[model samples]
Target: MRLLLCFLLLLATTLPARAEVAGEMAAALREQGLTGAVWALVTPEGVATGAAGLADAGTGAAMRPDHRVQMGSVTKTVLATGVLRLVTLGHLSLDQPLADILPTVAIDNPWAATHPLRLRHLLDHTSGLDDARLWQVFSRRPVADTPLMQGIARDGQALRLRWPPGQRFSYSNTGYTLLGMVVEAVTGERYEAWLDRAFLTPLGMRDSTFGFVTQTGPGADPRLAMGHFDDGSTQAAIPWFTRPAGQFTTSAADMARLAQFLMGDGMIDGVPFIASDLLRTMGRQTGTAAARAGLPIGYALGLQIRDRHGVVGLCHSGNIVGYRAMLCLYPDQGKAFFISVNADSETASYPALDAILIRALSLPPVTPLPTAADPERAKWQGIYTPLPNRFDQFAYLDGLTATVMVMAVPDGLLLTNMQRPDRMLLPLGNGLFRQQDRTIASHVFMEDADGVSFSDGGQSYQRVPAWRFWLGWLSVGAGLLGLGWLLLIGLWRLVLGPRSLGGMVSISALLALMLPAPFLIWGQSFLALGDATVGSVLLAVVTGLLPIALLATLFLDRRRTGLLPWLDRLASLATLQWLTVLAVAGLLPFRLWG
Candidate 1:
């Protein structure tokens, strides 16, 4: 009788704890105005799954724990696992050069003879390849049946290396797409089919799929959650060219299984699926300058070492058009959590939920242990500018805005930028540095053949002389002032004097330069610029004619004599100088579409 009473008391307490957690999850969805959400929590005891809100907001169908949602780039973790499986089976090697594997693919690497592009480099995002271009990501054309090589060939420029492979880290969807091609070449089968049979099935994720799933398809499940925008409008799934990079649909229950596998010792059903050492390598970075300098935190293979609320975890986040998801595994604590929301609302409080979940799991906070400051920190102090942006099209704008100044302070080093709040980095010996409240080393300074450089894993920056930095900003300021002066003078002259040939040509040039401004300001979407639409074509034409019109004005109005004319001449000169800088930066005649 006493034992029965104890068991009844335990059940009573557990049920309400679960109910309280469910209430918190529902309130989180309501606060964000989200259509639906699914989540899973994995602890040493067991896995718990929950759902909140509507699966189909229009149909009023309630979301179920089994309903599948797009996992986006979290697919990379599965792809990397499969690659590691192939390595263990002796079918592939991580250090194998891409030139040996795919001889026909056009990979332009200047340092290929020495530092070859290897499989591990692609997996770790140190391949030096650019991310997908605009058309590659936003194309409306159907790619469901397109061959991997054919899709890659459409944007061949993305394959060119910006630097030597294995030198640094830069995220590249193109690189992973190439890895999918490698899987096809080595296994003699479609990547989707192979991964489905070898990976998803073995892990007991029976409800998950490796390819695109559409609404009301022959094989589509009615339980598939509808993706939503901030206004609760539904969005249909579109076929992506880079399927292997980010195109898996999975349920919360299935994600729990995957999370369990990540937290386990590489065994499935008491059989060794992959070696424990190999699994450990999946979360560690190697062969990069930062890694060589004893900085171990970065994008390792597919997982990112993230510090959330002073607790370090192996984490990955994914986002498609209207769906967003995050997975975090704290292996040391035997705890993991996965959360997905149907709506891509910026106001969604992901961090709030993360904190709540952490507290619920009783995960311990990481203690900060600051080491002595590096005596050689003075060489690392200066203004540094970002290099080799992930997208070449945005390089010019990023160059102007992403510069950071590193200063040696009494405690450690200070990182200051105009665009973001200041960060204080504590020394961690051997040129590694981390924030005061974080456990992982988040910054590193290194010297190479090119020069001294600093990296935060994803982006790298090079030190520049102070004069060059000031001169670049000065040129930009002068150009803007000159353009404004010319616009005001041209309008005043038109109102005051007869419209002469010189006046008209000068005005035309000024207007030609400023025509793209409205499109930039009032443009509906950046995705529209990816294709050959009417607006994109107009932008391309105007930018192409900018230099020619400016040169013509300079020649046609050279002989005009007056204060306004001379000032116009000077303004035009300054504009021309700025245009020259743009030309050197390869942004002239800016064409958004292929």
Candidate 2:
């Protein structure tokens, strides 16, 4: 009894220090522009939990530690757990073909080219399934008749797979939605109902529930955090059908319980929720590189598996309407953190918040060291070809010039001369750079007196510099387009004076052709890069830009030639005729083509 008392006393004293550190971390976050509740739970034997920030901004109500917010796609982790539970029961196998489970739902693809998509493919997002424009279809449709599979099938029917099953990684929300359908088909119960029976009830996640609240009934918990838009306005509730992907509401305490259960050696209150080996398998690498963390990021079942500072991490992020949530567990440390906010202000950087959580846990900081320069930067310099839709390439000229026009990257900066404010060079080591903080990582040119290598994040990427091969081709295309525009402008001047109606009509025709031509042929490939897309879109918007000015000059101006009204009418007729010809000739199809 004396020994037990001493141990308890030691543990009690140690815990407050952890809490002190965690509290300081939270205070630092509040000091930044980011405002949201944070919950961190660390346990050696049991859980120590903490929460901070407002649950309601309007009322200034303090966020409850146990209040539920949308858990986002972290719901996928739970769904994957349920599926794995079934796998243990011998009811399903990871290799089971989708056609075997759902004969009616045809996953549209050329059937003969490869092996049919299996459960592993779906969970890993290597199923080669296309992403759905969920907001476009779901928000517009009646929720009842629009089944998950059908909604996916409709949108997916048209999209071509970038790769075959298990070939590479492509994050598809539609893939998980299909998993939800499989869950229902096998269990003969709705996905949420099965989860409730098999997982939630057993785990004692009492505050968590599926579907959006249609009403705040009597005695409802006032601590329920409201989701906020980037503009700080409250978001409307999403329909329930999308619940499996990210539609469930969960409290931070309940989410911590989940983290504990997952990190708790696969047990819940002394009972096994899942076998220890299966839990590890769920956290093992199942796919090619995932996007965010910049590596061959593993995905198993539904959760992302990553290793940071020697600790294995099981994590996911949830974003729906206005709500943003993230759950990360450092399983080796027996520590986990969950964050939920009523609103994520436009200025919020959730990943940075997660980084702070790591610091709060006293984990090793990702200290980026400035390595010495390599002598081969000039060898890597040139108009390296860029992969279509994958990367942007720029030739770095000088270090100081690169730093001034180029955003300061750690090693070097990504140099995007594109006009948008968001586009800039990001640094990679030894002077090579790549697009940083982007969805798809791209190559960068290094003029560090050392050669260039493909880079993402702070490390060198394994793939060869794709930008070098494709960028040359693109430059050629752009040069040709520029020469054509200049030639047209010169020809118009020689053929008719600048004030002539024919010259104006010809200029309008040239502008119409020039505006969309570059984007249709070239810019669409780079649209995935947000800043680059904005720059490209603005450059290509001549149709939206110049036509109105040309028309106003024709109609509103009082100075008129004797033939000017007739010529103006002729030009209008010509414009209509050109549009009619374009519609009938299927020239509009080029807009949809890559």
Candidate 3:
């Protein structure tokens, strides 16, 4: 009894000193303007966890080691871990065709008979499905009456493969969502439950949970910190039905444990949890994922493989509405780092902390991004389309940029981003480039027989054929002219009064609604307006009546004057041309009734 009392006093005294051990890391977070962050570092030597700033910005709660955070896409690692366990049991195979497993869900694979998408495609984000772009509107509350399977099936039917399977890397959350459904179909168990039993419980990640992350719920643990926005505004907690993709909530300590399991011998409490070899397999690059010099960026199964001066590491980064997270493991060093924060706007800064942890742990610092230019700029010219995405947003807008010109200038090239007409890209050698002085290494230039494959870091774009390229420009010019005509007619009506022009006010007003103003008025919020809204129905009605108004004016003129003025004639033609442009460019993203 006396020995126990003396040991307790000694241990309690040591804990506070250990908590203050990573003061340097806490200082880095403060320098980056992060509001709150929980970071845990595990090494073969020992484990240390540090958190700086408030756990809840609203309540001024001091951060704690056990505060839970939404894991965002890092949940993919957990999903992958569970699937690999099934693979070890002989219940599933990594190379097994996904179609063979989830037949109830319709997957639009044009080349399925030739190159069927295997289960590995889901893990690697190489499946030809869209990334569920429109479905982001369903983030908090999805469409009523739609289950995960139905949503996946509906999206699968609408989105065709942008490229052949295993062609190149294109991240898709829809693919991971489908993978979650596959897990349910085979085991007849819920994904979160299976994770808890197979992975979470075995790995001893007690704080991890799924569905909605909040301070209160039937199974709520209020130890989870409230999330905040970049502006220091409190963010309301929300649910994600897209389970496998983003429905994850965990703590730094629990994440560190998961990381420890990955780097360890795969035995916990003297029983093999998962094959250590399989976990290692999940850490390296897979399929046709490219590698650039100085920057080790490529996707492995559910992890991102990063190489810094040959110090290899497996990592993944994640984000929810108000929270962000990152986890990386260095097997060579027998070390792992996990950190998550409570603010959404500050999440991008979280990745930088990975480098800080690496250096602090005595590993090689991350390679500095390249800056030199490649003089051979002409080779970079081509008509590029956005990398195959589930959402047609970029494809439509970029397609209309009229086969964007990548012409060689004295120092660099002029490029169009669908939004900007011409932005100069200064070539930063090693097949990379940048748009502006303040930009990070933004462009990665890779070429093949199809054309030059270029990535602006966010989305991938490929060169298009000549004819389609010209059509894009023509369509864009027509759209601009059509918008100009509408504004001009409205101004003319304001001066001349609505009494003189018949059907002019209605047509002009309808066209103006098409410019996102109506969407803003009708959507639940500004962010929601990009897709659909309460006012979308009225907007769609106006759009549908547009051609009728133009045709009515055309026929009425045919019976009236002997000759029409050139401006009127051009206005009439431009209106008709604009509709054709919308159709050709595939910008019609919404249904009139829907």
TM-score of each: 0.92, 0.65, 0.81
Stretches off by above 4 angstroms in model 1 are 1-13, 30-35, 54-62, 153-158, 216-221, 346-349, 371-376, 494-498, 509-526
Which tens-of-lDDT digit does each residue in 316-377 have in candidate 1?
88888778888889998888988777877776766766665666677888887667768878
Best candidate, TM-score-wise? 1
lDDT of 3 by residue, 1-594 (tens): 999999899779757555554565567657776668887888886677778778777888988887878878898998888888888778889889987898766666788878788898788877766776554535334532236675454434544676777656678888888888888888888776777877788778888865555665565567888777777877656655465787788888888888888877778788776777787777554455344422234566788765433345788888877778888898877888888887777334565666666665677554444457677878878777666744654566546543455777887877865555577777777677766532345456777666677755335577777678776567667756865665676566566744224336435655556664555555455334333455555566566566566666666554444333345546666767767666565544244222
User: What's the lDDT for residue 181 in model 3?
Assistant: 82
Off by over 4 Å in 3: 1-34, 136-140, 143-146, 155-159, 216-220, 289-296, 307-312, 346-355, 366-380, 400-460, 465-471, 498-508, 511-523, 526-533, 557-565, 589-594
- Give candidate 2's error at residue 80 in angstroms: 1.5
lDDT of 2 by residue, 86-163 (tens): 887678898898878877776655642566778888887666665444232234233533466554544344434434
Best by lDDT: 1
- Residue 365, candidate 1: Cα error in Å is 1.5
Q: Which is the winner by lDDT between candidate 2 and candidate 3?
A: 3
Of models 1 and 3, which has the larger TM-score?
A: 1
Every candidate's lDDT:
0.79, 0.55, 0.68
Candidate 2, residue 32: Cα displacement in angstroms equals 3.6
Residue 389 shift from truth in candidate 2, angstroms: 7.1
